[model samples]
Target: MSAVSRLWRRAPLWRLCVYGTVFFAGLAAFYPAAYLIRAIPSLGKLHPGALHGGTAPDASKPGPGPGGNGGPPGPGDGRISFLPLTQGLTRAVPFGGHVLPLPAGVWHPVLSAQTGPNGAMLTDVYVRTDRGVVSGMVVAMGTAQPIPDPNLLSVDSPCHDDRAYARGELPSGENVVSCWAIGATPVHDAPGTLNPVVAQAVDRLNALGYPIPPLFMTMRWMHLTTVPKKGVGLEQADVMLSPAAPGTIRLPVPIDQWDRGAIAGAPAAAHFVDRMRVWAQEWAPILERGHAGTLDPTTIPDSLTMDPAAPAVH
Candidate 1:
């Protein structure tokens, strides 16, 4: 007791107070320093690049700033655009009740004939009929030789019809004639009679010097019987006018090899025959005038009979 009391009495008050303050300050500083040391690994994980110099920039991450890759326009961008030439020159014609238009560069010319070994100028004709639209690629040639009027045919004369006379009423010799190799699809459901509108239209074409035959009585029918044989490939039909037969105008209407399916809705054979009469009449002037050159048969190369298996008449 004597020694402890003596030591306490000897200790200074200011020194004791200073020692307490220093101890508290040390405790406070130690806790903060330990916390900072423990937090180093976690902070490094948060900023990997800061710790590792090889770290790459991650574009997909929520960025410190905005950035992106430029991409192409998608399908929903907009509509397409187009351009065409010869805009107004295009026209549609009805054949066999179907509507067809000339090829891009084709033009319909006024009726004119050709001569020599060149034969007829072939061209495609379109007609709209009750059955549908039908097309005929026709090889037409004209002769300078004059022909007698169809109305002036003699009784019992084989050339009584326009077609007969046009084909050259007689066989023998080189008959200067215009021939048409017409390939067509049949018309179906056409009125039993011709449509007057179509008839008039054809008549107008004839008047305009287009080589449609006058044999067509109405839009639906014609009296010409030879057309079937000439254009449709009927051997026994008797419409073909032989170049060798005198006074026998050979109207060899050669039809191409057609699929029966194509003719399903075409006009009846009888109706077609009748229409041929009108066609013959319409073409009479062109044929007699030998204006076959007006036809551009090359436009329809595939319509011609090129196959040996095809019928001789077609």
Candidate 2:
């Protein structure tokens, strides 16, 4: 038995346990793609004002955010999801208060939040207020209702009454509100379009005397981006919607640039929020039939024409 005990009895214990189980399964598949895959990275590219949560598979965006609202269910009624407004989303989005008066901590969203109808988030928040670089509508509407903005105007909160659940003031002095329950721009709303226990049709303003338990964010509209006197160049920004300037459908959504192939300026502001959802469905019933007083200016109706080559403001 002297020949190394007969070569340990011809050693090959199951071929050395199959070459040590194929060398620890080849270091457990190349030691994590060769050294823990470059310290794990890759999810940092969502800033077209970034904000993506749900309901966007392609509803009607032929060219923005690569398509979401994800088509295939329109009159059947059912299914709605949308997101893209941040502050860590928890059901209250009133950036820099007074719906963005800046100054305390500044604000956000200069562009990108078009997800509309029922879930309607809308966007364009900027503020350096005291009347300088003002841009509003950091809106969110799971339907707090109150669009009867027949030229809103009625203020006091100056900067942020916690985003004043009702501040109002447009005809261009700017100042805005009507925000609430915004934590990803919510809204599954329909049954009465929203308001106390589902009450309905409200541009309602006996000085905005309703809503006590937060039926959840009304978030009407607010638009104004004029900055000239030789200072225009945010691609020439100049949009002015929401019964502004002596009213009559304050047109001016000239945008001209920033499509960068979509996803950020949201196809350059969804060609003006598809004309503000065709003015909240055909000018919110003629702006709630002139919201109780002085709003006679109406006329840009080629389906609220935002000029797809100019022709529809019939």
Candidate 3:
């Protein structure tokens, strides 16, 4: 402060000139800087849709007729509707050998329908896999139809054909095959004990008139490499079964119960009850017709009674 005061006192006019130059320079820089900041698309505080020329007219300030292009309705104008299909779903059955229940639902409509080359559709069955969401539009069809190879549906590896409906592939037109239980990877925490219950259950289901495809039985191991800091770490394991395709059977268990068991040994029983309720409440009409020619629900086993020392059925 002493040195500054001395200098200012010695050269008052020079100091004034210097201060004036600094003040002008700051003032000159401010407007341009502000203009540049505003020029940045992301940095600007403008509403994104409005900035892109998508302005909706203010209805409060009324203008033209009812049919006028009031710039497209704002968020909730009833333009979109979501409805669950209330018809033709099969009853959920117990997954043959294990305490796990099979998933119950109709074949997702989009997955069931035939789509053209560039067509896209959303599916309701959401599976959270090791891969993120595992979402996106599948190529509907192409110029040529790919051959129906059994290997194409393998769950052990990534699917090569990402198309929803391959080009030239014919729909079997058989609606009875409502679901496809393909690529079910098994998770056996204790291999020797209750694991074989799953396989036994499959056998029991086959005896009870469900088509337990060979592909569905091929179980793969899921591995998790990262150490989970909180909660239960999700391993890369899943039982892939299609809920479309007729003659295909679904077990009544929700996916969560199948992934991990409840504290009590009653998930399988709960699944069976829930499935029956769905059948009674939703599919009663179609179920009465016996889609597969008089289904005897009584033939299905309610529980798997097994000895602890029994041999594994792998």
Give a tens-digit lDDT track for model 1, residues 153-202: 11112233332212223111232222322112222212212222122233
In candidate 2, how many Å is residue 242 off? 24
Candidate 3 runs further than 4 Å off: 1-197, 217-225, 228-237, 242-245, 248-314
Q: Can you write out model 3's per-residue Cα lDDT over 1-314, one digit (the tens) per residue?
A: 79878888899898999899999865443322222322432222233221122221111111121101011111211110111223222233211111111123221111111111211110111111111111111101111122122321221121122211101111123221112111222222222221221222323333444343222111111111122232111111122322212232233343334321341255553443333233222222222222234444433333221101011100
lDDT (10s digit) by residue, model 2, range 81-111: 1212233221112321122111112233322
Candidate numbers, best TM-score first, in rank order: 1, 2, 3
lDDT (Cα atoms) of all candidates against the true structure: 0.24, 0.24, 0.23
Q: For candidate 1, what is the total of clashing residue pairs?
A: 68
10 residues in a row with least lDDT, candidate 1: 63-72
- TM-score, structure 1 vs. true: 0.19
TM-score of each predicted structure versus truth:
0.19, 0.18, 0.17
